[model samples]
Target: MHAAGLGKQSLLIPKQPLLLLHGLFGFRELGPFVYFHGITEPLKSLGAKVVATRVHPTDSIANRAAQLQTQLSQVLKQYNTDKVHVIAHSMGGLDARYLINKLDWERNIMSLTTLATPHRGSYIADWSVLNIKQKLKIESLFKVLDIPLLAIDQLTPQYINECFNPEITDVPDVQYKSYGAWKQFESKFSYLYYFGQLLAEREGRNDGLVSMDSARWGQSFNEIPNCDHINIINWSESKFDIMPTYQKILSDLYHLEQQRELKWSIR
Candidate 1:
């Protein structure tokens, strides 16, 4: 759709609060470098209570999940609500899933909408930790830099297939939705374009980092056209506008919530 056609007036507001969870190396608010730039305010203006959470930027999913759980408790108490709808980007989605499944947070989460998350795995992560020798070297470097490299390990296909998949179970009560994006073409200015090309060559269609197939995990999935990994969250940076896309997502959730309430009333 065209950018001009995407207006906030047409967007529907949901009853539940929205908690925005950022991806790996992401923060809640970093001065001018906010993770999901120009997103929360518009959502709030639409009559939705929006809260962007802060988690350990480079920590493992379990550790980040714990951090999110704590933040979630505070947000729920502040909003006086029992549950919240989550809009998580990239690795944040996996963190939310870990919280819900492994940390007993299923009852506290109403719905989860994942954007370009590596559900199965990312080839980049696989490449990084290709062999035991390489993994050890990378881990040592991260340790020297005082950065958590365990999170990187968790993103690999081997880790997800062997360790994560077995423990993390999807609860039937929680509503799940996922979205993927693909880079249109390569550009010398954009590093994501180069990565996208590399991934497309190696792992089929991908949004720079995460492949479209890897991002598809929830009950419902969507593909956003002409968007790279970073631009999928902030499409205003690219030629495509993401405002309409986000509005549509919120509208869909609003309708879904209405339907859920109606079903409860009917029962």
Candidate 2:
């Protein structure tokens, strides 16, 4: 939700660069269209250095992380930043978590902030997996199209609970933050609305695609009220501005860096 008077708020970012990550079936850009929509350019205009990166649209987390690591290596070379903050949405959050945990990015990464991410996996994935006929058809189509199907299996709640979460433990020094949207539309024609209803039947509150509970992770979790999953990226049906929240997060990162520096000095 876009809060009134958010534009009046002024926030500043430090020297640390920001890396923006997109979710499943996402891309940096397709012609004039962007995955992060209005986020990157606006942040850049504010003097915050940022990288909006792309990964395999549908691939295993390990594969996606490898791709991200390669890009991050280049980004570090170009920017010369000691540490960077990661802002990831949806399935990209899982990829970020994996990169940090298994790939030993604890030293280079200062923080990770996720929006509408399914940290605990989603009911939608579970339902999709259970629906064998449909799943098979879709899998066959993806195979014919040469798209990987392993990523879809990984998003199931069971996989995350039993296999993933245990492996992807968080580092103490790297701060983690999360945000979720719970608002859903009642429109019958919208696919998100339909998924929202499915999730709502058992999950209480959802953001059309992901449940708020599933979205929650890390040391802090914030609610973007009256926002759906896509709305978090500024492309949803609402006109809610997402820049303010992005600015606030960067401001917070700056403060956190100050605190870290002070701690290092004390030691």
Candidate 3:
């Protein structure tokens, strides 16, 4: 029998849709941004709609959050649902938090799953500002990520403490989970690399760019080894195995939803 013949509710279990947002210097199409499609596909197969977002490449967190608010508002209106599940990567994680805390979208979301986000500012950002050659290399490689926006000194630790401390009452109703990645398996860079050294010094275990401590914030945390900063979302590498990590996250999120449902049943 055709799916259409089974009726509207036969195969579709409608819940609030999932939204995917990429990191700085990222687009909806880049290699580092493409693997999310795989994760979303599994979700859609489970009867959810996944919406991927594109934002101005150099916009501030505040501006980006405002833009996402508008976009999410439209998604809610279009689907006739008041909430969404957000999955954000890297700087996009900060942007998501901004949407919840700064823009007051706590009531309009269900949960958040952040992947390899630098909740604590990266020392690499600090190092790059001091070394012009490094800055140029980063700008050349990831041109979309504006250095001015990522300046570590300008981005005081206090900023991180204020925004992502989990102490802040940003989204009182939202449940949060974080995924941290580390470059445990062999990678191109070694500890001698400045960023690697920074990672080692600050986090002890890092994803080549961000440390585990930085990525894992709030109460719930998941950790994945053998993945780097970009590999957490990138699809180009065979060695990275980002798919399994995302699959595990999706499974955990599903379990969380089930737990919530059980709680409601008890109520």
lDDT of 2 by residue, 16-52 (tens): 8899999988899989898888777767766788899
> How well does each candidate superpose onto the true structure, as a TM-score?
0.91, 0.93, 0.77
After best superposition, candidate 2 residue 220: deviation in angstroms?
0.8
The TM-score leader among the candidates is 2
Clashing pairs in 2: none
| CA-lDDT, candidates in order | 0.82, 0.85, 0.68
Task: Sort all candidates by lDDT, best to worst.
Answer: 2, 1, 3
Residue-level lDDT tens digits of model 1 in 1-267 = 224554567878887889999987789778767788767776676687899998888799999999887789888899888978999999999999999998998998989999999988787886656664284676677778897767777898778878887888788999999999877566777867666776788778888899998899878999888888877666445556777778877888898889888999999
Please identify which of the two predictions, 1 or 3, would achieve the higher TM-score against the true structure: 1
Q: lDDT by residue for model 3 over 34-80, one digit each (tens)?
A: 63545555556556678888776555676667778778988898899
Full candidate order by TM-score, most accurate first = 2, 1, 3
Give the residue spans of candidate 2 off by over 4 A. Answer: 1-9, 130-136
Model 1 segments more than 4 A misplaced: 1-8, 130-138, 235-237
